[model samples]
Target: MAEAAAITWALELAVIEMFEHICIESDAKVYVNALAATIDDCLWKIRALISMSLKLSS
Candidate 1:
């Protein structure tokens, strides 16, 4: 879950960086921590997907 949250945060940052001006908001601290936990098991796949999304968005 931590991995997922980190991926989400990364993706959000990527989008913000790509767009230049935009407000990103999230109220789920638990979800954010979930992504930051570790890139193990299925979390790695989630991270890959987020990375791909950022690349495609860019």
Candidate 2:
């Protein structure tokens, strides 16, 4: 959840800054894998954050 929150926050910042491209690096392999999956497959705890991150990233 914490990792997801950090990613979400970073993505939010990138969106606010109008960045054309961004790269995210994390040591949390499990969370990274979760984020790579569809929202429906996301863990319940980080689902909302992941959704928001995906939206901001796109």
Per-candidate Cα RMSD to the true structure, in Å, reads: 6.7, 0.9
**Candidate 1 local distance difference test against the native:** 0.50
Off by over 4 Å in 1: 19-58
- 1-58 in candidate 2: lDDT tens per residue? 7878888899998998999998899998867887789889978888888789888988
lDDT of 2 at 16: 89
In candidate 1, what are the lDDT values of residues 1-58, reduced to their tens digit?
4544555566677776786544435565544343345434324535665445445435
Candidate 1 accuracy as TM-score: 0.33
lDDT minimum window of 10 residues, candidate 1: 34-43
C-alpha RMSD between model 1 and the true structure: 6.7
**What TM-score does structure 2 among the candidates reach?**
0.89
C-alpha lDDT (0 to 100) for residue 30 of candidate 1: 41
